[model samples]
Target chain A: MSNKKVTGKVWKFGSDINTDLVIPNFAIYMTREEQPAHCFVANRPGWVDEVQPGDILIAGTNFGVGSGRPIGDVFVDLGVFAVVAESFNGLGLRNCVNAGLASLPCKGILDAFDEGDIAEVDWGTGEVRNLTKGTTLTGQALPPEIQSIVEEGGVMAKLKKEGFVS
Target chain B: MGMNAIEKILAKRSGQTVVKPGDVVMVDVDTAVSFDYGKPNIKKIHNPDMLVLLHDHVVPSPTLSAANGAKSLREFVAKFGIKNYFPVGRHGISHVLVAEEGLALPGNILVNGDSHTCSSGALNCLARGMGPSEMTYIICKGKTWYIVGPTTKIVLEGTLSEGVFPRDVIHYIAGQHGDFAGRNLEWYGPGLEAIGMDGRLTMATISAELSVEFSLFPYDKVLADYLDGRAKKPFEPSFPDDDAVYDQVITINLSEIEPQVVLPNKVAWNSKPISEVVGKHVDQAFIGSCANGRLSDFAIAAQVVKGKKVAEGTRFIITPGSQEVMRQAVKAGYVETLLEAGAVVTNSTCGACYGGHMGLLADGEVCITASTRNFKGRMGSAEAEIYMGSPATVAASAIAGVIADPRVALKVKELA
Candidate 1:
């Protein structure tokens, strides 16, 4: 796994933030490069204009709960560094990992950070440090296999490197 | 050590004598399904014979972008020499068509790019969804690794009350137990005898709503009958050992279940009795999706709306799950009854279920749908509220312009 630390501005959301809120089906037909512009447009208009590269998203329990649309492609295209949630939907978690977006599941992390707070996440050590608040929280680390896939920049790249794909 | 159905399927495919939860093993895929959205990402095929390409998400090309995507999928199918491709007009919702076409069989390990792929698990297959990248890998390698999940045994007893369908039973399960997130559920008991293949498919289709990794029914006479002439291959039925250990066991008495509805925003958390939500105004009523868009759903809706007209202000839409289902409904006169009642009967697609096309709700509208989910902005506007129910309830609500009880409507029909 990568030992590098990731620091970004936090975008906090409430519980049960589903995939439709992240990327609705209307925008699903757009090419990967063009779809990021419509991310979170339904709930938070002008979100794409405000969000910068390497930003971190944090949410309450049952985050990304909905159809297994590849919403993670938008995250990857927009250069989202990682997602931190109290819990996650199983299919959404898999999509995020496959897209090379790090997903950290931490209990009570929503209570510790607010919107726009700068946070630093260390994947190898499982530490989520709220740099703005001067506090830190320990999150559950991904399994070694999953972490390695993310570190290698998604399953496609890993498979290609291993000669599984052309 | 005893093994469950999933374990047996995985072991057989991987050529292993035994398998258990958390064991990572690479197994051969019996069937791999891809839709319009997923087909664009697949670069190569490790086994052309194992892939099934379906065009149903944006059937008839709702927009220019969707048409372009469909074109890309068609090109991919041609380039790969894939023989199992189903174009628009010939295809329906991937989940429904896969089963109808006999792509998934008992004891097979099936994977699709859509979360609703779990619907095929009702036939006693180990079916589940994988992400796009993982799907690509599977297509390239014809094999993928899985960390077997601990199985939960859910036993259903007694029989469902009239007008109370399998959708109600699933809603009750989700209402009582928050979400089966991260768990694999195995269903069995006398209730299986009561709920046949169609009802079991309804139950398995919503497994994604509860975040279940996989939902499976045991191999029984119902499944055998459903697969009689449809199966691509003749296979032996697989079952869990008599002493197989389960992580958890949940038993529900089906006789106690009433017609149910899940309120807006959260599909699983909020569940109220049908009486409580009845008479609530609804602007739209939909009866289709991979979950409940079959011949049975249409028959129930047609029965409810036989002699009645759709409410003045409501837009009622009916979409069959597949072209085959559509033809069957037409042959049975259900299509004519639905059309005569002022309902818009559209082609087989996942229309309006994901707000993709065919009946999007405007701002502040309220809709009662027989589809799977009701998350914010799922059907249309985020400000709009959505209620989930059975097709019978939706049809009744369409005629009354409010959430009405299906039993009352059926009673009125019988009296008339």
Candidate 2:
């Protein structure tokens, strides 16, 4: 596992944030760079414009709840460094790792901090520290293989390096 | 001391005799399915014969981009010599068609790039959805890794009374237990004998809504009979050991169940018996999806609304699960009966369910759908209301022009 740290502004959201809310089906046909603008269009319009680079998204249970459309790429395109939710759908969690997004599932993560507060994460140990609130929460660490995939910048990048795909 | 059904299937596929929760292993895939959404950038596939390609989502290509995507997949299919390809005419919702075509067999490992791929677990296989990225890896390797999670044992006792269906069964399960995120679910009991393959598939498909990794049914004579001629491959059935271990067990008496409706939006723990939501006005009655769309659904729906006309101002739409299902439905005379009842039958696709193409609900309209989901903006306008139920309930509502129970409507039809 890669030992690295990231600190970013926090964007708090509620539970059951599904794929349709992250990026609708129609936006799938759009170019990669053009897709981030439509992220969270259902609930948070203009979110793309407001979210700065290196922001961290925090949410309640069942985060990324619906269809598995690889929302991690959207998070990466939006410049979100990491996602820490109370829990995640199994399918969504795999999608996050495949897209190389650093994510942690920490219980009581919903109450750790308010939106816009700064939070720091240690990818090696799966620990999240809310700098603004001076609080820390333990999270499930990524398995060794999964961490390797994340460090390599995603499954596709690894596959490309291994000459599995073009 | 022993393995459950899912454990046995996973273990055998991974070349292990025993596996428990938290065991991670790479498994050979029996079948890997993809739809029009796949962006094929692969240099080589490990096994083309094991792959199943089809065009169902965005059927008829509502947009120019979708049409272009379909064309690309066609090229990819031909380039790889993929023989198990289903084009638009024979295309269907991948979940429904995969099981219908018998690509999934008992004791096999089936993977698809769609969330509802869990539906095939009803065939008593270790089946679940894998994302496109993982699917890409599978295409290159013909194998994928699975981290086993704790499996919950669901016991269904007794037979379901008339007017109740797998839709209602699932709704009742979700209403009481809520979502099982990061977990697995296995179904068995006396109820298995009473439910058919379609009913078991419905329960498994809707289990995706509960966010289970895999939802499966135990193999029995019921499944054996269904797979007699439909099995496209040789296979062995998997079953839990006598002393099988489970994380938890929940029992439901199917005989006690009645007509049910899942409220608009998320369905986890948000459903009620039909009596509570009666008379809720609905403009559209939809009866189709991989979950509820089948020849059986059409048969029951046609019977429920046989001689009755669709209520004035209420639109009833029926989309079969697949072209094969549509053909079987037509031969059964269900299609003609529905059309004579004033229901508009559309080509088989994932239409209206995901709100991709046909039968979109207008703003401020209310719809009662037998499809998988009822979330806001799922079928059309965010302002529209969606109530989910069985085909019988939805068909009965089409005649009543309101969200009415199927039992009452069936009684009315008999008296007529």
- Candidate 1, superposed: residue stretches over 4 Å from native: A1-4, A116-118, A130-137, A159-166, B15-18, B37-43
What is the TM-score of model 2 when looking only at chain B? 0.97
| Candidate 1 residue lDDT tens string, A2-120 | 46479999998887777887777667656677778888877788988888899998988777777767777778788789998887777888888888888888888899998999999
iRMS (Å) per candidate: 2.3, 1.4
Using all chains and alpha carbons, the TM-scores for the candidates as numbered come to 0.94, 0.97
Candidate 1 lDDT, B178-198, residue by residue in tens? 776667899999987978777
* Top-scoring candidate (DockQ): 2
| Candidate 1, position B111, lDDT | 91
Off by over 4 Å in 2: none
Index of the highest-lDDT prediction: 2
Backbone clash pairs for candidate 1 read none
Candidate 2: Cα lDDT at B23: 80
Tens-digit lDDT string for candidate 2 (B275-362) = 9999989899999989878999999999999988999989999999999999999999999999999999988888789888778888
